[model samples]
Target: MTATTDESAFAAENAFGKGEPNIAYAQYFTGDSFLNNLVTDPECVVGVHNVTFAPGCRNNWHVHHATSGGGQVLICTAGSGWYQEEGKDAVSLTPGVVVFTRAGVKHWHGAKADSWFSHIALGVPGENTSNEWLEPVDDAHYAAL
Candidate 1:
């Protein structure tokens, strides 16, 4: 489905309730999305968040970097979505599918054109862990999928 189509559908429930507004840094995403931090305690080594993407919503290419070890893991919890690493084929995401993106990889993920999707993103902690958000995915490239 094209991102601009009118047939988009949203499931009754997409995992844990769509938490608070995303409040993502404006430069990081191309469309609407939300983020719900699930593990914020200082003692927790892993950061957990529930991300909900509106139909056709997607973030820009980014990387989770760490000097030794650290990356990001996305566990699909509801609806449908897509994930793609730089120079790799786009992967369909459904409930239970897990995408583990190792550190230093450039990747992007979001809801499909016609579906609202949700997933739990686990942030693996490591020395000097940081996120680097890059350019948005172009429309032509995204529509080709």
Candidate 2:
């Protein structure tokens, strides 16, 4: 399933509060990770989640899609991490960095081998929004990063 962390670790490393970690749904991720629902506004078409990844924790390749227009944005709020799209070089993540994975792009994001990481995940709302989860990021691929 999911992993738990000592709250102090995040408190010292992150700019934002590392709210209680939610059991990262098994259907979506690989290794250990947690989620904090920071904001959910259905009316304004916006939602934000704080996600924490212990060292080496990551999710599988996935896609966010919408019939009209929508995708996902990640605002790095703490520590170090990695983000990669299918067939592209992995980008390093740190505080103040923002990543925009447009709808229909296959990608994955997670912590580095020796560092914990957190990001504020923003959901860009659109009609017919949905997520497509695919295979895990292989160990070999990650090890090289």
Candidate 3:
């Protein structure tokens, strides 16, 4: 007997592969943005946050907070961008490549020096998940990229 499962949210719950679930739409975050909800799972608390940086937009320095520890991943799906940590050098990123950071590091990321940037934010699991925003990435630093 087939015990069919109710379609909770992910439209392609029964899908094989190679496509996002119907429920997971390609979202666009025009202006400044952040995570809306944090995932709650034992295996790994994971969530996807879509961000779009305007021509000259960027985020301030920030740190992730998790009981077990967590890091941010930027999967560039469009345009170009730069990422920098507190004491590390800046790195450029484009479509297809994935960038990562440590569990808790002070850093900032944003669009490229001459274009907009967009990526999906994914992180590990944590308790009392939160963030601490420090300072914005100045133009001098951005232009250096």
Candidate 4:
């Protein structure tokens, strides 16, 4: 192992990497809504992120790999949203609603098609937690919302 020393590099900070367009994921899931992932803990630590959905927005199908042994938790902070597991009906997720995702379960979630939504997402600290980003839910699937 290479020996390393602790250091701090503080530069002029202006934003929390939010001003840019469609930066977190890669493409727009729904309108301007996107995911801001902060994988601070590589393993044995917690990970955090935020999902902000604009009016008439949603997200594509995706899954989270267990880090150590836990899954993910989503705390709705503003507006409204929804969460559903694979092969299950969508559940309503509004302000004050907390949702937990099962480890290694394939699922998708986002704001209601007609409302803006924002939520803080957190995952358990584990050994090499991974994320599998799947296909975007097209208009056909979104129209059903």
Clashing pairs in 1: none
Find the candidate with the highest TM-score and give its number.
1
Global CA lDDT computed for model 2: 0.82
Q: Rank by lDDT, descending?
A: 1, 2, 4, 3
TM-score of 2: 0.87
lDDT of 3 by residue, 61-88 (tens): 7888766767777776666677788888
TM-score of each: 0.90, 0.87, 0.66, 0.72
**Top model by lDDT, which number?**
1
Per-residue CA lDDT of candidate 4, range 1-145, in tens? Answer: 1111111110111112222345666563756755566565566366677676665566677888865676788887665567777788788777678988877887777766656566778876556788887777667755675
Candidate order by decreasing TM-score: 1, 2, 4, 3
Residue 78 displacement in candidate 4 (angstroms): 1.0
Between prediction 2 and prediction 4, which has the larger lDDT? 2
TM-score of 4: 0.72
lDDT of each: 0.83, 0.82, 0.59, 0.64
Task: Please give the lDDT score for candidate 4.
Answer: 0.64
